[model samples]
Target: MKSLYAATCALALALPAAAAELETYLEFEKAMPPGNLAIGPDGRMFMSVHEFYGPELRVVEVMPDGSTKPYPTEDWARAPQDDADGLNGVLGLRADRDGILWMLDGQGENQTGRIVGWDTKTETLHAIHYIGAPVARPTSFLNDLAVDRDHGAIYISDTGDGQNSAIIVVDLETGRARRVLEGSQYTIPEDTPMVIDGREITLGGNPAKIGINPITVDPTNTWVYFAPMTASAMYRIPTAALLDESLSDADLEAQVERYGDKPISDGSTVDTGGNVYITAMTDNALGVTKPDGSYEVLFQSDDELPWPDGFSIGADGYVYATINELHRSPALNNGEDASKGIYKIVRFKSLADAVSGR
Candidate 1:
């Protein structure tokens, strides 16, 4: 006899055109700490645990019935307490073309960050690259990364403390990195202020300034889209221009294109069709930009999504997001602790259809 959870998941996955439905799949009891998420080809979810103390990374296998088995592996959980100089824990999870999971360890404040790859089959950990200063700012918060599997190059965003935000490019094969756009027009924050909860929030303590947060590459791997958390506008730079070593700063600056105004978005991902989905923290919604340059509210859930952070689109087309209440937490702003949780806007395409059709 199949369990109820399994039956529900079976029916959900069986529905071919059901991708557009707006639904809440799961929620954690306590607030989910800051983190990043990656969905493997097999549908298993890998998520990072961002906090002072907890499993540095966790793997959850969603059963056929929708129940989750959280098996925290030793290789992913081990922290170097003694070597406090190095990156201690994982912040972002991304799976490369070979089906191996890559974890971005943002060594906290003073330490150099590192990217570690885990073999899911053997549970072995391998250090692919260590991202540090001179090329990247010492205070660089290597927040998120996108990989070009074909070229073996990875692009990382350095959300510095202030106007020093930059984008660092790394050659996976050579283990060498270079800062492509530092203090460039596209790398800086926009001039528009972000109004959240009826009060304006400043970027790096400056009003109406731009501070780069999360970035995502288009499905075609042609463009990289980025936005500052404090600004509503989004911008993009062609991958050709960014990856070209010969392109002058002025030449690269002229190619930047302003995508348009979006909600206070944190993490972003693009589907196979070139539709970009952004986790809009302020609006409590997922903002969708279609290929035709039109924007629409794909889904909005005030109760389901609060301070939605990094998210990834599963091969099945489902978009999962982490709802971290950074704004609600007093530690960040006013000493208020807004509990965080992980939530998924299941059947995103179906929900997009339902919302737009209405």
Candidate 2:
């Protein structure tokens, strides 16, 4: 039997540049994909698919040669009996130090939202936390998640449309979860309407509204930064404030500071220097916010970089993102899905240099 580490080592090689002008990587064939990306500690790339009805999860491994291989499994869907109608899709994925793959289950159509962990060593699945019933709206769409392994906690964004929108903090050790920020103020709706390709659009065919969607935490477990999928303002709060039960709601709210006025950002990640890399969907560019509260466009691709969904800062100093054409589909406010591909921007320095001023 081959180990996951061995499998990864056997495939390590230099991937040929896909494009000369831009750093082109392999494009995994996907259909209507959602939150689908996870980078292993060994520098291997993995992505999943979110097809509407069937074949919910399609896992793919990107080799160093810029080639791709798909995991032979259509059984990634694990729907509980309670939410039989909901669809099982892998949204946010994180491989902890133990090689366990933690996934955020965004039960799309069927509406059952939960978090599960896949132990590759044991080849088993375990439900770490379940979100449903009285605490949160059953239809609440749990989007992305960021884990603080040092403190054993996970912060998730509940981007519930109309029904509910809030940030959920889960205690990994205790299996307890709480809804910290809720309603329009904290989970405020976007003021400027979402205009894609000269037309207004909304995700899931509903009216375009602001809700907290994608989130990313700093490497030191100090801050968790997030923004609404359609909002222009970026907000964040200290992990200490969020994890502390003694902090009053007003105190926690006061700690939530506006990071900056950003474009339509779907996903974000911070480097070691506390610089936040945000996928600005509206401007079709990748924006970077330094530690000094200043933001700038790191890289800009023509309209081809549409609807950038997730962010993964590679050890090699390249920032990767998934460009899902969510606004293009009619179900998402009648937008068009063009230039949908995974993209990476490489810094002219090593990961350490990118973090520290070389």
List model 2 lDDT by residue over 277-330, tens digit each: 777777776676656576766567655566666777676666677766556543
TM per candidate comes to 0.80, 0.80
Quick one: best lDDT, which candidate?
A: 2
The stretch of ten residues in a row with the least summed lDDT in candidate 2 is 11-20
Give lDDT tens digits, candidate 1, residues 103-175.
7777566567777776765656645688877876766777778877666777887777547788888787888
The CA lDDT of each predicted structure is 0.64, 0.65
Give the count of colliding residue pairs in each prediction.
16, 9
Give the TM-score comparing model 2 with the true structure, all chains together: 0.80
Tell me how far the alpha carbon of residue 44 in candidate 1 is from the true structure, in angstroms, after superposition. Answer: 1.6
Candidate 1: where are CA atoms >4 Å away?
1-20, 52-72, 83-87, 199-210, 340-347, 350-358
lDDT for model 1 comes to: 0.64
